[model samples]
Target: MTERLRRALDARPRLTRWLLAGPGAVAAALLFAMAMPIWLPKGAAGIDNIVFPLILVPLIWAVVFVYACVEESLLRCVAVICGTAAVCGLTAAMAFTGWI
Candidate 1:
């Protein structure tokens, strides 16, 4: 193997990757689960809005997780995760309070 290839293969994931891929993915998933119910405008078929999001959130989480795993910058990863979580949590709270 080439020296570059060997080095690349030998490298381990850093703490940022773990933080983003783990907690970040969880945060994104929480948003998908909660925010949609509030943020999704009402529709003809009442269940579709909720059901469709439930189906879609896992896919979203997987995508976010993969992106987080590959993201090199700690600041970006934290921002994305915390930002998403805060938005979702706030939305969920507002909905619970009948503000939505």
Candidate 2:
């Protein structure tokens, strides 16, 4: 690891890093799940809606996991994750309200 990377990792508590990173990954997944019904085209008796989102969920989570781990600031990581969750929640709400 580069000196700066090592220093960044060393500066935070391991548990705190995990706490932030874990939720960021989980939020990414939930975002994908929750957004599926809202944004996916409903076709073939709804299989199309379910299939693509399920396929993308892990990809989304992996990307978010890496980003959360590599990001330099804990607060910014939390902000990104929480913002993602909020957007997902809002989109799901819109679906329920027949807005999508």
List the RMSD of every prediction in angstroms: 8.1, 6.2
User: Ten-residue segment with the worst summed lDDT in candidate 2?
Assistant: 1-10
Give the per-residue lDDT of model 1 (tens digit) for 4-61. 5434433644755776688779777877578887767668877866887788888888
Pairs of residues clashing in candidate 2: none
Please report the candidate that would top lDDT against the real structure. Answer: 2
What overall lDDT, based on C-alpha atoms, would model 1 receive against the true structure? 0.73
Q: Per-residue error at 25 for model 2, in Å? A: 1.4
Best by TM-score: 1
Reference-based TM-score, model 1: 0.74
Stretches of candidate 1 off by over 4 Å are 1-13
> What is the C-alpha local distance difference test score of each model?
0.73, 0.74
